[model samples]
Target: MIEHKPLRLLRHLAWIPAIWIAWELLHYEQYKLLGNPGSVFLFTVLTDWLGFHGYEKAMRLGVGAMEIAASILVLIPRTQGFGGLFAMGVMSGAIFFHTVSPLGIDPYSDGGVLFKEACLTWAAGLLVAVLRRDQLVALFNRIAGRDAAVPA
Candidate 1:
């Protein structure tokens, strides 16, 4: 297992660049494969969800900074847990927005995009959860130890 650690790290690290590239591609409209309407809807949803409705300029800078920080933390072994937590928070907000806005799946309509986003968010959260499992286990163990030491 130890021998494969490097490969595993590489795979995880690759997601960062891939995500960045995809973001850039979308931002520049270099790839319209997803359709303009869908892209516009997604951007509007993101901006609104992020509380940048009337603050587009600030959000433009803030979002990039936040994303870079999150990506950097995620790639750093010592800070991966923190990064994962941040990612989970952002993704959860996204999922909530989609679910609450009537933008999600519909049996008779083309609402599958929301479903796809939700699934992706879950997958990302799961990745972080798995990455931080050891820390979680250790925290629980510490709490259990403290309880065991109590006189009651």
Candidate 2:
């Protein structure tokens, strides 16, 4: 059995908040830097998808809080698995948004912002995989045993 030490787990957990803060800081001026047209278009899409129209300011704040809560949940041993899954969904949505927006116009156009987003998406997936490796292994074992027990 793979042993997860508390210190090691905490170290990995620390990356969750650290990374989110870094991303927010780095992209604080994303709407302005990328252009207002694109910003308005993306925001509209977000509002429609999240059903948070007429309260854009509150929506943004809520999203940030949700991200923080998810990260914190992922740090707790008992909730880490579910939290990781939630984080993965959030990251995946981010990746999809970037891909389908003007953000994907050109890799070189936005100072490699799309590239950074892609990297972050992959990082989130990798982190979740690492944190849940034992669960994944167990799942695989169960499937493999079932296959072996079946008659040809």
RMSD of each: 8.8, 8.9
Residue 39 shift from truth in candidate 2, angstroms = 8.2
Best by lDDT: 2
- Candidate 2, residue 26: Cα displacement in angstroms equals 12
For 1-152, candidate 1 gives per-residue lDDT tens digits of 15368646644654554354234323433212333455455555557766668554454445445555665555555555455555556556546756666444432267665456545644664566465555445545657884322110
Locate the minimum summed-lDDT window of 10 residues in model 2: 143-152
lDDT of 2 at 123: 67
Which segments of model 2 are wrong by more than 4 Å?
A: 1-55, 103-110, 135-152
Clashes of 2: 0
- TM-score, candidate 1, is 0.48
Q: Which sections of candidate 1 miss by over 4 Å?
A: 1-53, 102-111, 136-152
CA displacement after TM-score superposition, residue 52 of candidate 2 (Å): 7.4
